[model samples]
Target: MSAASLPGVRLWTGRVLEDLRAGRSCLCLLPRTPAGGADAAAVLDELLHELGDFVLLPAPGPADAAAPRGAGLPGPPAAAAPPPGGPWTDTAPVLDYDDGLSAFGVGPRGGGPVPSDAASAAGRDTPAAHGPAGGGEPGPSAAGRAPERGRPTAHDLADRVLKELGAAAPGADSGPAAGVDGLLHRLTDGSGAASRVVVVRGWHEPVPAAAAELLRRLAAAVKAAGLPPERRPRLLVLAGPSGLAAELPEQVARDDVAVHWWWGVHGRLDTATVVAMARPPAAGRAARHQLLEAVAQATVVEVCGPFLDLAERLAAEWDGSPDTLPPQLRRLLCDEGLLPGVPDPDDAARTVPAPRGPAPGAALPAPAGALREHWDRGLADRWDGRLRHWPGAAARRDPRTQETGAPVWDWEWEHGVRTRIWLAQNTALLPLLDEAREAFTEVIRSRSRLPLPDLAARYGPRRDGVPGPRPGTAAAPGSAAALAGMELGDMWRAHIQGDARLSQPEADRLRTLWRSRNSLSHREALDSPRLEGLADHLTR
Candidate 1:
C-alpha cells in the first residue's frame, strides 16, 4: 500500500513524534503480500507522509537485493534531518517504508512490538508489522557499537514504551476490571520504576479479600515513597471485560478500608466508552460528577497517556526541594481558570485574580437535588448527613467567616475511602476479631453457629439511622464493650444446642472462640476453660 491510501495517519504520526522525542525508537511492520488493503497499510501510508526523512525500501529477501533499499542512505530528505557533527548526528530519524513488507519494524520504538513469546501469550491483538532486524529477540538489532538502556536489542524501544504503559504500580495498577493474573510484564526488570502499579483488577472474583490485598500493597508503596498521598491522587489504569464493570468499587469496599482511597482508575479509552461512561447521571454525590468528568476527558483523544504521565510526574515530581509546594495546588486547586504554577493559568491569574463568569447582570443557574445539597453544605452550613468521619475530621462552619470548615488540621483525603473499599473487596473485618470468630465457628462443628457479622462494615447498632461500626469490624469508642455484651459464649451454646443441634463438647469449641476473639481484640490471650476449648478444637 502506498502512503496516499492510509488512514489514521495523524494519530500514528503523533505517537511516532511522541516516541522519538521521548528518546524511543519505533518501526511500522508491513505485509509484503498485499492482504488487500488492510488497515495497517493505510496507517503505514499515513506515517510515511507525516515522516519526511523516512524512505521506503524492499525488505531484504533471503537473497540480496540488487540495490538494497531501506538502509544505505544519508537517511532521507537532508533538508529536515539533524545537521552534521552534533549531539543529534548519528541519531537522524529515518522511516523505512517497506513494500513487500510482511511487517514494519519501528525498531525498538516506544511503540508496541510483536510478542517474542507469542505462542505462550495466546491472542495477539495487533501484530507488529516487522519483527526486529536479525529477529534475534525482538526490537532493533544490536550490531551497533554502543550499548543503550538494554544491550541495544530490537526490543528496547517497545519494551520501554510498554513498561510505561503496562506498569502495575500499587494503587495505579489495581482496579475491579483487572485480574490478578491478567497483568503480564513484556519487558525486562530494572526498567524505570512504575511510579505506581495500575492493575485493572476488579471485584468480580468471589474472594473479595484477594482484591483488598492488592490495595493494601498500594497504600504500603505510597507510604514508602513518601509522596504527599493525602494531596496527590495517583492514576490507576483499569480495563476489564464488560458487564463485570460495576464490580470494581464494590469488591474494593468489602474490606471497608478501600472506601477512603485517593486512587483513580481509567474505565474508558474510546469515544463509545466515553459516551457510555457519561449518562443521565446518578443521584449520588455531586463530587462523583467531578470524578466522572475527569475519566471522560481521558477516554477521548482530548488527553494522551504520556501527557497524563507527564502531568502526574510534574504533579508528584519534585526537585527534592524542601520548598516544594503541595501537589494539591496542581491536582486540585485552580486559580482563575488555571491550576497554580501552570504558565498559561499563571499568566491569566496575573491579569485577573478570579475566573471569568456570567455577565454582571446575569443570574447563576440554580443547582439540582444532590448538587443543591452539596452546595448547601458549603453555603448555608447544613448537613444532608450521609458522611461519617474520623471524630475530629468532621467539618464545621467558621462562625466569623461563615465558610465550611473542618476543625481538624487535616480532613481525610480519599485514602480513607479507598481503605473502606479495600476492606469490602477483601470480604474481611479486623484480623483479631472477625477472622478469629469465623475460624472458630468453622473449626468447631458441634457448637451452634452463632451467625457472625455479615462481612458488612456496620453490624451492631445504627447511630442515627446509619450503620455504626459493629463488634468485629473496626469499632469506634464503644467497640470493646459491645463485643463483651454480645455474650458470645452463652449465645453460641444456645445456638449450637438449639440452632446447630450440637452437643456440649461441640459447644465448648465455639465458647472458646468467643473468648479468644474478645482477647485478641483487646490484644491479649486467654487461658481459661473457654479459651482452652478453642485450643483443643484447633488441635483436633
Candidate 2:
C-alpha cells in the first residue's frame, strides 16, 4: 500500500515534512514489528527524495529477527540523474550540499535534478564526467554501479557519516569530547548545508560507548541546532525494543523535541480495518461485512490468510451437511488453526503428552477426591498448629531495651517472623496444588462441619451431639506414613508410572522435600531448593 493510504504512515510523513519546513528536529519511534519498520523507512525514503543531503544509519549489532530480510535499500533506489550545483550553493557550508546529496542520488525540494549515486560517483567528483554535459539524465544502468556489500551496522554507519562530514576522528589526542564537538559543529555550525537531515537507527544495540554517547548528546544538541531556527538540521532517531528511549532523556515531554510513536500492527490495523483488508479493495460492503466478524476475531493481523482458509474449509466441509455445529466448537477450531504462533498439527503431535493413566501393574488408583480431601484438612491443621506453637512463639521482654517492658520482641522472635514472611513470599509452590487444595476443601466443607471427608464417610455422618474422630485413631496427612496408612513415598510411587514418571532416585528426593517443607513451615530452617522441589513435584 502507498504510504499515504495508511493513517499512521500519513501522520508520520506529514509531521516529518512539517518539521523540516519549520527547520526543527524530531525523534520518531518506529514499531519493532516488520510492517511498522518498513512503513517508517518508506516515510524516510519519501523525505529523502523530497529533501536531499540526508544520511541513513543502520541500527547497531545483528538486525532484529522481526526486521525485513534481504534488502537492497529499505525503499526504491534513485532512478534519475541529479542536477549540477544549483540554488542551495550559497547556503552550502564547508562541503557543498550537492557533494553529499549525490550519495543517494536525491535532489532539493520542488522537483530538481537528482544527483548520481555518490558511492559510484565517489571516485569521480563531478556529474559531468558520468552524465551528459547539457544535464541529460545519466543513462548508465543501475547494475553497472557497485552495490553495497551487506547491511551496515550502526557503528559502521556512524563512522561513515562522520567521515562524510570531514570529522571522522576528532583529533588523535583530543578525546571523545572533541570528536562529539566536531560532529555537532558539522551538523549545526555554518559548515554543513542548512536543513540537513540524518536518521540514526539501532542506538539500543551494544554500540560502542563513544557512538552511544554521541546519540545521547543529540538529545541536548537538538535544541541547540534549532537555536536560530532558520539554519537548524532535522534529526530523526529510530530506537528498537531494547528500551533505549528510557535510557536517554525523554523527548515526548519536551517542548522543543517532537516525538512520534509506532506501536506495531495491532495499533494501526483494528478489527474493521482487518476485515476490509481481507477482500479486494473494490468489493461491495455486503461482501466485506460478511467476513467482518470472522476477521475481527483473528488474534493477529498476519493470520488473516489462515483465518480465511479455515473459513473456506469449514464452508466446503458443511456444504451439504446440516449446519448444527456449535459456535464454541468452531471458535475452538479457529483458535487452534488461525491464531498467530499457535502450533501446527505437526507441532501438536510432537509435544509431550500429559499423564493420563495410572502406572502399569498398579491397581486402579483411588479417586483423587479421597486423597485430596485428606491432604487439605491435614495440612491446614498442621500449618495452623505449627504457627501457634512455633519456637519463640511467645515474645520475651528485655528490660534494658524496653522502658515499659510490656513485651520486648527478642532477635529470635524477629528472625522467626522475618524468615516465615520471606519463605511465604518467595516459595515457588505450584498453582495446581492450590487449586487442588481449594477443590478438596470446598467438597469436604460442603458435606459437613468435619474437616476430613474420609472420617465423615467412614463414620457414617456425625450424630447431633457426637464428637469428632478419636484423636488416637486419626493422623494428619502431613505424617510421612499416614496417607491411607501407606508411606508417603510409597503412595507417590504407586500413583505415578511409566517412563515419564520420576525414578526410584526421586523417592529419597521426596523424603527430603517432605522434611524440608516441614522445617520451613515451622521456621526451623530456610531452603530455596526445598520450595523448588515441592513446586517440581506438584507440576510433574
Candidate 3:
C-alpha cells in the first residue's frame, strides 16, 4: 500500500502541510527503527511532493577531530585527506536539487524576483527592490563558490542554500560572506517569487555540536523573522527515534519547532488498521474477520513492517487450506491457551471411561475452524480416558466446575494472559484513561464545595507547598507526608466518593472510571463491556 494512503500518514502529513503553509517551519521526528525510518521518509517525501518546492540536503558531518565544539562555524582542515564522497568532498555537494522539480515537484530552479509587470499590477513593490520585510543587508551571493576544501562548514551550507534558490554565491568579489544569516536573508528577502523549502535528511544520525548550533540559529532566525506564511521559507529536519530531540540545543528543541511523529504518538500502530492490513487474500468474509480478531488479540506493538511480513508468511504457508489450521495461527493459539495440545495415543487407549452417561450440560465454546474440532475431540477423549483412573476427575472435568466450589485459578496463566492483553491494547487505553482522569479532576474542582488548597494539603505529597523527595525514594513509612501523593484512583476512593455535594450517579460514574484506571495501572486490560462503559461515561 502507498504510504500516503495510510491513516496515520494522512493525519500526520496534513498537519505538516498546515504548518508549512502557515509559514511555520517544521522539525519532523522520524522513528529510529529501520522500518520506522523508511516509513517516515516515505511519508515526508509524499508530503513534500504534494507541496511542491523543497531542496533535499544531506546532513553535515564533523569537520575534524580538533574542530571547536558548538562554535556554529566550520573548523580548519585536518592534515589527512577527508574521505571520498564525504560531506566535505567537492564531488558531492551538500544540497541535492536536480531531481527536486521533475520527480518530486520540489526545489524549483530560479530564485529571481517576480516580473515587474506582475508586481506593478498587484500594486505591491517588487520583492527584490524592497528586500524582505525583516530588514537585513544581503550578503555577497555564494553562487559558484568552490565548496571549502576541507570538511563542509555552516558556510558551505549557506552557499548551497543560496545556489539551490538561484541566489548569488559569496565569491571573493561579493564582499564578506553573510554566512547563515545571509542564507536566511536570501530565502526571506523575496528575491524569489516561488515558495522555497530546504529539507535536511538523515538528521537522526549523530549531529556535530557546531551543526546543531547552526540549526538552532537558523530556527531562531526563522521564528523571529515574522514574515507572512507565503513569504517565509520552509525548513524541515527529518530525524529519528523520538528521543533524538534531546540531543538538539534547547533553542531548536523548544515548542516553536513543530515536531510530528511518523508512527502514532506512542510509537505503536493502530490495532484496527494493522489488522486490516493483515487481511489474507481470497479468504471468506467470516473467516477473514475471525482471523483478524486473532491477529488483533495476539499483537503487542503491531509495528507495520514486521506485522505485514508475518501476514505474508501466513498466506504463503496456509496456501488457501480451510480445514487445517495455519501454523502461525496455531502457534498464537497455543501461546494464548485457546487451543489444547495433542494428547498421547497410548494414554488415550489405556485409561478406561467412567461409564456415567454424558453429564447433562451445554458444551464449552471453541473458536471456529477444523483445528478447533480436532482439539475438542482430543480434549474430550483425553479427559474421558483419565476419568476412571483418576478419582474426582469427572468433577474437575466439568466446564461449570467453578459453580460447585472456589475456582482453582492458575495465577501464572492468568497473569500471562493479562500481560499480553495489556501489551496489545495499552497505547489506546492509556490516552483514554488520561482524558477520563482530566475530566474527573475538573468535576471535583468545579462541583465539590471542599477547599482545593485544603484537599491538597491533606492528601497531596507536598504538605507545606515544598517539593518532596523524588518519586520511589525511601521515606518514613507511617509519616503523613510519606503517605501522601494521591493518584486518580486514590483521589476517587478517598475524597470523591465521600463528598456530600456530589450526587450518587456522578459518584458511580467516577467509580467505574476509577476501576478502569486501576486495572490499567496494574497492567490488566478491561473486557469490552467495561471498556465501553468507561468510554460512555467519559463522553457523557
Q: Whose TM-score is greatest here?
A: 3
Tens digit of per-residue lDDT, candidate 1, span 1-540: 232232222433454444333322222212121111123324433444554432122222442333232311111112222223221222212222213221322122233233343321321222221223365543222111121222222122222223345444312332211121122121112233332222211211222222233343333333433444232212221111111222333333321122311101111132223233333444444544433333223321121111222223322332211112222222322221221111232332123222233242222112222322222222111111112111112233455664433223223322332232233212212333445555544433333243434211223344466544443555542334333333345446446445446557656656665656555455342323433344345445
Model 2: lDDT of residue 131:
41
Q: Please list the Cα RMSD from the true structure of every candidate, rounded to 1 decimal place.
A: 27.9, 25.6, 24.4
Tell me which residue pairs clash in candidate 2. Answer: 82-114, 82-115
What order do you get sorting by TM-score, best first?
3, 2, 1
Residue 59 C-alpha lDDT in model 3: 31
TM-scores for every candidate against the unseen true structure = 0.17, 0.34, 0.41
Off by over 4 Å in 1: 1-405, 408-438, 446-540
Q: Considering lDDT, where higher is better, how would the candidates rank from best to worst?
A: 3, 2, 1
Off by more than 4 A, model 2 = 2-4, 34-43, 59-159, 166-178, 203-212, 219-226, 243-253, 264-274, 280-540
lDDT of 3 by residue, 300-401 (tens): 222122233233333344332212222344444334343433234454422433233222221111112222222222222111112211111111122455
Between candidates 1 and 2, the one scoring higher on lDDT is 2
